[model samples]
Target: MGILQRAKPLSNIGAKQVGFTLIEMVTVILILGILVVGVSGFIIFGTRIFVESSSIDQVLSQSRFAVERMTRDIRNAVPNSVRLRTATGGSYQCIELLPIDSSTSYLELPIYPDDALVSGTVIDNGISINAGQYALVYPLASNSSGVNDVYQASRNKRFELQSSSSSANVLTLTFTGLAQFAEQSPIKRIYFASQPISYCFESPIGNSEVKLYRYADYGYIASQPAPSQMGTAVLMAENVSNNLLLEPAIKLTEQNLMRNAIVHIEPRFSVNGETFKYQHQVKVTNVP
Candidate 1:
């Protein structure tokens, strides 16, 4: 009886020891592996979406800033002073314009058919006139070769200032020399301007991406200067992918008898795998 009881207890213990088989253990592990892969895929997909959206938003904000700045400058440009140029072979594009520093009506000026004078008079409008700023009168046209153009150093339409004096609200402006205006403004308005400004879109050699640069404080030149010939370049924006030969970055429609000057701004910016374009037109509001 004792031996039978001991044998029965041993058989029950052996059965308890055989808890799980290799096949069952592997089946459970396979299920857990599938669940881990599915969860990891979901996490990876969400992370990619977040990264792409952030990149797009960043591009939008930068583009808006660039467009707004350009628009404001174009709107305030000197009358008939906006001009556009593009590379013939496809490397760069630029738009140049003169910004008015101050403007007021003139009381007396030396017009055409009259002898040039060394001084002119204007009704003081509280704006201080300084030397080295150009006085423009009846600036109505732009020339490719700069003949009778505002960019010229010696033109009848504009002259450099020597000095200014104000008394009894009547301001006397002294010219650099004997100066005569080509034509008188219909409204007798005169504009004072500083240096011309140029905005260029350039691509590095062997690169397809383009960038916007602002050139200023450069003195007037009869011929438009390229990026290499400009002043210190200030970076405006980047990630441009427009082809200069096929699609120019800047275009201008000069003001005519029937319409006002319009600047067409079209720049395409690409970031990550996404791209956006601006179809903006800025109208020049100041007239001679």
Candidate 2:
């Protein structure tokens, strides 16, 4: 009259436990390590490529902008006003130019050997002559002797404007003083120039990188001023690697009867051991 319970099988109790061995666990860990190393290597490689490419693109873009800006300035500069300068040991190189504010044909001018006058007549082309602007007549070159040079403050080549008035189709320009032009332009063309602009490539004393800078509104000087003596400088480009002693950064070919003036620009930029140079030439459109 008593109840009974079933017992476990003897075979099941004596069987070995079922699980992974030591060798199996080690093999799995080794495979996982290989996969991790491979994935990390791929990620590192992609990151390095992206970084290098971005650095190169940045340099290219900056260098291109600087070259184009310089080209535009040189093309529109006043005739025969482009000048180049360099230091004694080629530590720095500069190109100076005067931008023209207004240009027109002159009806009358006080040219030597005639008496100097304070007023002159020009064709009324809706030209505006602001104060502090200089009038240029027959500017042939910047390095010419006597009054033929535009950089000189001589009344024979350049003079300050005081006021301007228009009547019918004629514009009368009054000079700050009795000024006489050295020579008459064959086409009777006159130019009004604002302040001088300079682009200089300078290398720091203890640094290997050369930087390009722009200086403007610094007024005129008989001699080209260094970067330290010039007006506020704006950085244009960096990593310049030009050898000024071997070849100049800016070269000028004066205008003659055959061709217009040409400015040659050769600037080199480097980044990440990669270097590129621009061989650009800009021609002056206006002639005296």
For this target, which candidate reaches the highest lDDT against the unseen true structure? 1
- Residue-level lDDT of model 1, residues 1-288, one tens digit each, is 355444443445435344788999999999999999999999999999999888888778878888888898899888888878888777899998999899999999888888889999999989888899989987876665545367765667879999999999999999999998888799998999988899999987799999999999988877777878886988888898899888888888988878889999999999988888999999998888
Top of the candidates by TM-score = 2
TM agreement with the true structure for every prediction = 0.82, 0.85
Tell me the lDDT of model 1 at 24: 93
Model 2: lDDT equals 0.86
Question: For model 2, how does the per-residue alpha-carbon lDDT over 70-132 read when each residue is reduced to its tens digit?
Answer: 988888888888878888877889988898888999998889988999999999998888877
Off by over 4 Å in 2: 1-28, 142-148
- Looking at model 2, the pairs that clash are none
lDDT of 2 at 132: 77
